[model samples]
Structures are given as C-alpha cells and as structure tokens.
Target chain A: MIKLNSNLMIHQYFCLMIRYLKKQNFWFVFTPYFWLVLFFFIPLALIFKISISVSEWGMPPYRDLFSLSEEGFKIDSTLSNYLFIFSDPFYIRSYLNSLSLAFTSTILCLVIGYPIAFYVAKSHANIRIILLVLLIIPFWTSFLLRVYAWKVLLQGSGIINSILIHLGFITEPISMLHNHYAVILGVVYTYLPFMILPLYGYLVKFDLNLIDAANDLGAKPVNTFLKVILPLSLPGIIAGSMLVFIPVVGEFVIPEMLGGSDKLYFGKIIWDEFFVNRDWPVASALAMSGIVILVFPIVIFQLMYAKYNFKNE
Target chain B: MQNTILRMNKLFFKIFTLTIGFSFLYFPILTLIAYSFNDNKRVMVWKGFSFRWYKELFQNEQILEAFYTSIKIASLSATFATIMGVMIGFSLTRISKIPARPFFIFLSSSPLVMPEIILGLSLLLFFISSNHIIGFPSSKGQLTVLISHITFSVAFVAVIIQSRLSSYDKNIEEAAQDLGTIPNMIFWKITAPVILPSIISGWLLAFTLSLDDLVVASFTTGPGANTLPIVVFSKVRLGLSPEVNALSAIIMLIVVLAAISVYFINRSHIKK
Candidate 1:
C-alpha cells in the first residue's frame, strides 16, 4: 500500500511540473506573438491590402485626382498612383518642402538644444530637476492650442505686429503668419523638447576630463568644442535629428494652421487626399513613398552608427 | 586683449544659446498662457481681464464630454499597455532559451520609428477588415480607440520596463528559488517588488502618451466619440480663444505638479 501511494505521488508531481512548463512555454512563445499579430502586423498588412486592392465603387473620388487624362478612371495598381505623385510638380514640390523644413528644424533644434542639455547635465541636482520640469511643462498642453497661440502672435493685426507698430520698428506687420518661416518656427518650437531630452541623455554621462585635457593641450575653446565635444556628442545629435525629422515629415496640423491655405506640404496634401478628397489610394501611395524615402537613409545611418562606437567619449 | 576677446566670445555664446533655447521652448507656451487671460473673445485682440471664457468652457457640454472620454480611454489603455509591456519585458529578460529574441525586440521597436499617419491609416484599415470577417468588434467606438492607444503605448512601456530589467540584479530571484520557493512565489515576492517602481513609471508614461495623442486618435476615433486633442484642434482651426488657452494652462499645471510630486517622492525614497 505504501509503494502504490508513493507511485501516485510521483505521477502527480510530474503532472504539476509539466503544467508549469506548459504555462511558461505559453507565455514565452504564444502571448507576445498573439499581441504583435493583433496589434502590429495585422494592421500593417491591412494597410497594404487596402492600398493595393481595386475599389468596388466606381473610381473612388481620390482616383481621379492628379489625372491628366480627365476621364476620372481608377487604376488598381500601385504604380499609377505613384506615377501621379511623381509626375505632378505640386506633389513633388511638397515633398521637397517637407524635407527642407525637417532638415532645417532639426539643425535649429540641435543648435538650441545642446547647451540647455549641457547646462542641465552640469547643474546642481535641485536645479537640474527644476529645469527638466520646466522643459516638460510646455509639453503638457495640447499641441494644437500652442500652434494657435503662435497664429495670434504672428498674424497681421496680432500682438507682435501691434507691439512692433507701436514701437515704430516696422511700418507694417512682417507677414509672419501663413508663411514658410512660420511653419518652420512652429515645427522647431513643437519638437525642441524631443531634441533636448535625447541630447540630455547623452550629455549626462559625458566625461568632462576630455574637454579639460583638450584645453590643457593648448586647443582654443572653439577648437576644443569642435574637436572634442561635437564628435563625442554625435550619437545624441543623430538620435535627436531622427526624433525631430521623422515626426516633422508627417506633421499636418502645424502647417495647416500656421502655413495658411497657400503653403503646400506633403502632410497637408496627404490629409487633404485622405479626408477631403477621400482618395485612399493616392494617400497610401504618398505615405508609402514617404516610408521608402525615409527608411533607406535611416537604415544607412543605423548601420554606420552601429559600426562605430560614439559612446566611448 | 586676448583674454578679453575670449571672455566676450564665451559670454556671447552663452547668451545666444540661452536665448534660442528659451524662445524655442517657452515662447509659444507663455504666449498661450498670456492670451488665455486676455479677456478678449477675439484671439488677435487683447481687451481686458475676465474669467468668463473659463466659465463658458466649463459649460460647453461637448468639451466636457470629450475630456471625460479622453481620461477614460487613457486610464484603461495605460493599464492594459503596462501589463503587456511587463509581459514582453519579462519574456525578453527572463527567458534566455526563447528563440528570435532580437527579432521580437526589433518588431516591437519598429512602431516607434514609423510615422503616426501611417500607423493610424494602417490600423483603421485593419479594423475595417477584421470587423467584416470576424464579426467581432461589431462597431467601432471607445473600444477601437483604446485598442489603438494600447498598441502604441505597449511598445513604449516595454522599452521602459526592458531597460529597467536589464539593470536589475538576478541574484535575488536565484536566492529565493534556492530557498525552496516556487517560481510563482519568487516572482510575486521578489521580482514584483524590485520592478514595481518601473511598472508604475511605465504606466504613468503610457497614460501621458495616450492623453497627449492627437493623430492616432483622429484616425481610430469613431463617429460621436471625440478626444480632447481633436476637439481642441478643431476649435483652434476655426479660431483661438482664451477658453482654449485656459484649458491648456490647466493641463500644463496638472502635468507639472504631478511630475514634480513624482520626482520628490522618488528622491525621498532614494534618500531613505
């Protein structure tokens, strides 16, 4: 009787172990993939399928857009939609405009963000915390409201103009609103925090001894900064640029609000195509083109970054 | 003469950097806050001071409803995203035998690099297809919005938790197991305590992302369900008002206070 009972106990123990292993296996294998499929992969696949498939309704209104033929006929393939975007001067210009704006804003962000990051990194603990909070506080407001405020300030009869006119600085308002400069300013303003935080992360762990060594070696301050600080901080610059550039490429609201009706941007164009024109195909084509243009450079940068160690500084 | 020139250059650089940084970061925000108190219904004109706009904003039923909806979606999505994040983090860190760990990591991080518009459009298409075939998610509404938020928010949470886990010591868990503790008990009693702070921080971060989101919400939100950012965007597109400014100021205040409180709390704990 004792032997039988011990045998049964061993069997139960084996069963329990198997159950535990199964649970672990399920969690490790099944669960992550399940969520990824449901959330990520499926959605991406759906987008591709939607963009490619022929519209059941007669040439969904978006298809007729940018057509030189004027027949309003829809083509089911990806090439024609892409061709339309590429062939059109308006679309091509918008892409170039977005690129320039993103590049400029990123450079502006780097110029503005680096010192603040350096200061915060070198500051006393209490001051650092306070400065960090100050940096983040502006982010809490709706981005839309902030853009609108810029509109008020930059408008013809706006506060900025009123002040300038009262002071006799200029005879008229500077035509700040609804201009390319306003769009760039808005983009730079909105994305500055993104630039600062990454730079701050890199700067925080930066070694001060290198700068001291460079100075002791008789390098001028500018030379020291150029030779020592800049190269050492390249990772932060790259990361910050990526952060600012990627989002700015797809930004719609800022340009729409501040750029006014006349200014054309890829984001505004895509928004118009998708929502107003109901042209999913062309919008998808534009979106896909954007992804293609960005992905290649990003991959190249990543490869280069991985090949070299900028973290040693 | 050389020393004076160097000093002047340094001073100029310092002033220039500070001016540029502050103007870029703070001007728009300060302008909005200032305009909120301008007492003028016209955004372009500064009349006087009055709290009437704030009163009007509070009374606007649409704004209030949108605010509540945003809070609800943010809370729910943040909670679920944190859970998924923790799970993914645990899988990546704990399960060494798991194949393709790097692939999973890449897959998770890919969303972070993708543009918001693409993500939004893709998710919308996904929902429409899934609804047609599966017959589940019978209608799109809060459920769709929350699901979409969680999809992106989880990646952020996972990134945070994974970094935290990488830095955590493993000996504590090993010691617990050697003391005849079961895996479940060891996880609950030891791993959970060590990682709880990260989990909380991840949740808070996810919540903030969900709250601040505009683009994704625009794509996923169904008819009659508007988030706060969307409402604010539409209103501002029409015209800016002090009420919008007041609303923004209140949000800014809350976020600042909460962040400071968290910082102090964390610092005190470290001191202890």
Candidate 2:
C-alpha cells in the first residue's frame, strides 16, 4: 500500500511539471484557440445548422422555407429558392440595379476621395490636421440621421428644390426625391469618408522623392502623377473599394427611403421575404447566395493582395 | 513659363476637386441644420427664424423614449463589448503560442466584413433556435439587442485593443511577475494603465456604432423597444418633419463637442 501511494504521488508530480511547462510556452496560444472556438466558431456553426435545418425542422414559423410547398416536408431537397431568385424578373432586376448603384457610387467616391487625400497629405502640417478634422466631423453624426436629412433636402418640397426655385434655376420644382439619383447620391455621401481615410493612410507614407525623380527625368506633371503616384496608391484604392462596395451591395435604408417604390434592390427583397412574407427558408437561401457571390471576389482580392504586399508598396 | 502654367493647371484641378467634394459632403448636413431654424409649418418652406421645432422635439414623448432607449443600449453594449474585447485582445497578444491565431483573427473580423442585414438575420435565426432548444433567450428584447450589439461591437473593440497592444512593451509585465506580483494584479496595475486610452476609444466606438445602427436594431427589437434611429427612420418614411431636423442638429452638436474633447485629451496625453 505504501509503494502504491508513492507511485500515485510520483504521477501527480509529473502532471504538475507538464502543466507548468505548458503554462510557460503554450498558454497564450491555447487560450485564444479556446476563445475563438467558444465565441466565434460555435455561433457560426449554429448559423450554418439553422440555415440547413430550416426545411427539416420546421423552424421560423413557416416550414419548407426552401421549397414551393407550404407544408413542411423531409422528402426531398430542392434548389427552387435559388432558381426562383434567378428566374423571377423582379429579383434579377433588383440585383442588377443594386450592383450598378454600388459600382457607380464606388467610382464616384474614388474620384472625390483620392484628390482630397492627396491634398491633405501634401499640405502643411497644421493645415493637414485641420482638414482631417473637417473630414471627420461629419462622420461623428448619426449615419442614419444624416441619410434621413438627405431625404428632406431631396424631396420636392425640401430645401434643395426650394432653393433652386428661388434662385430661378428651375421654373418648377424637379422631382428629385425617391429615385435612382437620390440613392446613388446618398451612397456616395455615406461612403466618401471610407474611401478618403484609406487613401490618406496610403498617401501619408508615400515618398515625394519618387515624384521629384520623375520630374527631373523630364516627365510632365500629369505623366509623373499617372506613373508614380497612381501606382503607389493602388492598394488604397482596392481597400477603399472593398470597404465601400461590400456594404453598398446590401444597403436597404438608402434605397428604401430614396429609391422610392419605383425601384427595388436586393436588400429590400430579402427584407420582404423574411418580414413581410414570413419566408425564412427563402430569405436564408438568398443570404447564402449573396455570401457565395461576395466571398469569391473578396477571396480573389485577398490572394492578389497577399501575393503583392500592396499596402507596403 | 511652362512650369508656371503647369502649376496653375494643377491649382485649378485642386480647387475644382475641393469645391465639388466639400459641397457634396456638407450640403445635406448644412441644409438639415439651416432648416431646423426655419419658422415654417411646411418643412421645406422658410418663413422666418424660430426655435419652435426644437421645442416640439423636446415635447414629443415617443422621441424622448427613443433617445433614452438608444442611450441605455449604447452604454450597456459598449461596456460589455469593451470587456470582452480586452479579454480577446489580451489572449491574442500575450497568449502567443495558441494554435490557429490567424484563423481566429479572420473569424473575429468576418463579422465586420459581413453585411449588417445578413448578420442581423443570422443572429435572429440563431436566437430563435436557442430559445426553442435550450429554453434560453426567452424573447428577443432589450437583452437580445444588447447581446447582438455586443457580438459585433466586441470585434471592433478587439481590433482596436489588439492594435494598441502590439505597440505595448512586454517587459513591464515580466518585471512585475519577476517581483512575485500576481498575474491579475500585474494586468490591472501595469497593463491596464498603458492600454486605457485604447479601452476608452474602443468603448466610444462601440457606443457610437450601437447608437447609429438601424438595420440590426430593426431585426432584433421587439415592440416598445424603439431606438432613436428607428424612430427617426419610421418618421422619415412617413414624411419629412422639422422636428427630425432639430433632433439631428442636436445629435450632431453633441457628437462634435465630444469629438473635440477627445481630440484635445489625446493631444495633451501625447504631449505628456
């Protein structure tokens, strides 16, 4: 019995030593792994399960969310939800509309943001600080409130029309509100800061010596900017594009408020499916499709970005 | 002479860009501010200057309720998010030997990249399932809203704290440990002080994000759980109102003041 007790004691000491070694070398690594599993991985796994099981379990009030049948069934899986999305003219049109709006707004933001970022970076130190503050002040306001405010200004009886009529720029109030133009304008306004900040981050680190060298080599100012500055700023452009484009694709509020009933976007369609129609399966399917489409481009961009250390360049 | 012309052309381009850009950025906000003071029954028509709309905004009960709700949620969510973020940040930085660190980083940031509507929908579905299977999350209300806010806000806080932590020196904590200080004590005394600025900024960011969010709030909120953004959104959908303008102006004013204070505080701290 004494020998057995001593053997147990020896085993306990060996375990303690192992634990201490792990604490010294592996604690940092293990703790984060545990946290990621607990908080992020588990929740995402649950999301995937819910998406897959909606048809099987009859969750979310309505059943067979993925199929045309109202009755919940386990007989077969159908791609009707996805097929319907593509075949339906309304859904296809909304998708196209949203894509175009996001594209145009992204381009507009780039055009407007790049030069301002350039100027702010090149300006004197105090002026740069002041300009940056000016840029950020508008951002501090509630983004929703800002969008709502834009709605007021664009409405027929709103401030813009009133000012235009008073100034004799138009004899009659133009129907500016609740249209494609308003949606594009709101998107560009909201995302402009996103574009500018990344560009500014890039431009601040840009070497002026490159431009000076190009000029000394007898390159014209336009050519120097196109050759030296633009190439260097490509990373910022890509980052800014992702930042703006990704969210704009799923934007519901700006389109809902400004695009009026005349236009429909993908976000509104998804909202309608879930809330108004109570079709959870179809909504989940739509969301999954959007994820699939968006992830492809993002993955490609990230691969290219990694291949070239674009930010550092 | 050629250089002078080239310089003039560049200057012209700069001015043109600045004018167009600033006008687009500032016009709507400026219009909102100006119209709030206009003394007219109709929102668009300007009669004269008045503070009537501001008074009306204060008098509205629903609007006041919304303001209170938004403030409460923002404060609660920011606090919770900051605590979780600090833990995650500590784990990522100090606990370096963990397997799959890059994957963890990607997972945490994935929420940020995902569209808000999708995140909201997925969370809503998740909560519904949990309520059914586990009998927890009895209903989606203030608690659910707070949890959802924390879920996203924590990621932002984690990113911010991680950035701050990367710049922190590890030797300070090691020295504290060498003196036989407890790990938690070393964290509180040595590490927390160094990262306090980042903690505050993270908290503020989370607060603003919760306050500004509409889509997620829409999905998670039950009846009587209206946030300020939802109240304003529903009202805007009905029609334009001067009270909304007044409310926006007040909100913007508070934000600007807070930002200025933060800027000064940061500057002074840097000087020190």
Candidate topping DockQ = 2
What digit string (tens of lDDT, one per residue) describes model 1 on residues A189-287?
Answer: 888888888788778778888888998999988999899888888878887888889878888888888886566888778778778877777777788
- TM-score of chain B taken alone, every candidate: 0.92, 0.92
Judging by lDDT against the true structure, name the best candidate: 2
Taking the tens digit of each residue's C-alpha lDDT, what string does model 2 give over A1-313? 9999999988886787577556764454345335445444555555554444334334454343244456854444456667767788988788788788889999999987998889888777767776777787777688887788788888787767778989999988899988888899899888899899888978988988898899899998899989899999888888788888888888988888878777788888889988998777677777776777679656654544333321221
TM-scores for the candidates:
0.87, 0.86
TM-score of 2: 0.86
- Native-vs-model 1 lDDT? 0.77
Regions of model 1 farther than 4 Å from truth = A1-25, A28-32, A56-78, A297-313, B1-16
Every prediction: chain A TM-score: 0.79, 0.80
Worst 10 residues of 2 chain B by lDDT: B96-105
- Per-residue lDDT tens digits for candidate 2, residues B151-188, read 88887798788767866678888899999999879978
